[model samples]
Target: MNVKGIHHLSAMTGGITVNYQFYTEVLGMRLIKKTVNQDDTSVYHLFYGDERGNAGTELTFFDFPGIRQNQKGVSSISGTSLHVRNDAALAYWIERFTEHDVTHSPVIPYAGRNVIFFEDPEGQELALVSDETNSGVPGGTPWEHSPVPAQYGIIGLGPVKLTVRKPESTLAALRLMGFTEKSRIPALVAGQEDIIIMQVAEGGSGGEVQVEPRDDLAIARLGKGGVHHVAFRIEDEEELLAWIEVLNREGLQNSGFVDRYYFRSLYFREPNGILFELATDGPGFDTDEPFETLGESLALPRFLEHQRESIEDHLRPLVTKRD
Candidate 1:
């Protein structure tokens, strides 16, 4: 079974309010879902994405108030890159960042694209890569309520950068999941490590994964602003189960099968310690609410419906302007 591309990239956050404002007001992504972590209902789970909350466009967060800042190093997802239409889109973002006082780096060239690096309120490394070649999935819909116009809004997730001590095992696991090496690039900055690019069978901008060797750096600690896990897309339950079997046969320990309500999931860790997940593409964000009114109110799965009262009472309420 071939893993298609990124389903969503989930990270940890310390302040939900600040995160909400930064992502919605500054980044211009739609707040697609406002729910609680299924494993830990006391905290909020926020999802931001393009219109319809499509598979490749999602960037989610788990709010853990008072959580310590993450220790960055090897064995972590260091950065997430979002795709922009072209150079003009990159320029638009630079201007927008300036107006909002967002911290950003000047546009630089890497991997045959112009990239502008930035950070969120909590310091999650992020970048906007100019996919001038229009190399992303076709027919991606932009959020209509986004402050940024649809023409320049992010197309989808671009190459995600992962820091690893060694690439052998990680590359092996990825190969089993249907990813093929695309290319490699030497480090542009002094003291930085070289990078290897991996792409799915249906290769494109969003389908790429960039791995940087950081063997000399210390291992990363999970905390606010660090990625919790990176999820890859599977077609449906059938593909999900097939992958579970494949992983089991390959002696890879994984979370058997998890019913996430919206989509089923399977969790595992690569040899380098970066958490990975295979998530189905169907029964998405709209499963709990209509597309027109997504992220409007607290949503709970059927099993958690009995605790909705307490869940809502324990968590702070969120109001999305466009919801």
Candidate 2:
């Protein structure tokens, strides 16, 4: 199966405002869209990324207004590393974090790249890394609201980092999806050797890592403050279908195809228990809004038509026309 790259990453959160401030004001991503969660209208489904909010550029969050912040452990998502242009950008981000008083660790190497690690207000881990490997595919077409200049904006998502209870089951599923053993590194923090790294050879999206849980033996499971799923990108429907066949042969559960407005998605779970999605790149974010205004307002795929009004009501106003 020919998998293009990462599509988008989704995580759960506690509030809409904190997400808006962290993703935009702190990280400098453009607030491309302000919409509500299609599944639950009361919460917002916010997307922050480059001007165009391209596939890999996306970091989406679902806000559950009063939910308690969840623990970050073996069964939770570890972190997401975003690819940037160089150390200059990385340094700029370090200073940016300092200016906001957001605590973060110094740069460290992992999977053959230098990365700056930090946490969102709700404790979701995120990283910014220089594109030293130059592996990311070209970012999608430009959009107006992006904060970084179009050229230096993200090319695509570097690999995602996942921590699971047992690595074997997830490793089996990743192999079936064509991910290969890249290398094994010492745990990024310290006093740990339970880390394993994997890469998608054909993917232009960057790299992904899966780690063994620090204290137990089970797949990382999703919950209130956990990552909802990780989406991998494919060139088109045919390539997507081929992978569906590979997944079935491996006995993994997969939902054939579902239209998600801009792109068609195939959903499944990896062996270590993380939700995985395979999404097509077409009918992209540019489909609903013109390339000129891709992230300007609420955009609901046709399937969620009836809930639009309520979705709008619950979201705290973000990038307004004036700003």
**TM-score: which candidate is best?**
1
lDDT of each: 0.87, 0.69
Q: Model 1: residues >4 Å from true position, as ranges? A: 134-136, 188-193, 321-323
- CA RMSD for every model? 1.4, 2.9
TM-score per model over all chains? 0.97, 0.87
Query: Cα deviation of 259 in candidate 1 (Å)?
Result: 0.8
Q: Candidate 1 versus the native: TM-score?
A: 0.97
Query: Any idea what lDDT model 1 has?
Result: 0.87
Tens-digit lDDT string for candidate 2 (1-323)? 64555678888887677777777666667666666676677777877767667677777888776776665566445678777776676777677678898879888775677778888887777777777665545554333445655544554566687777667877777776667776777765666555777667454335465555454433344444568888877778787778778778878788987777677788997765678888887766666667556556777877776867866776667553424
What's the residue-level lDDT of 147 in candidate 1? Answer: 90
True-vs-predicted CA distance for residue 210, candidate 2, Å:
3.7
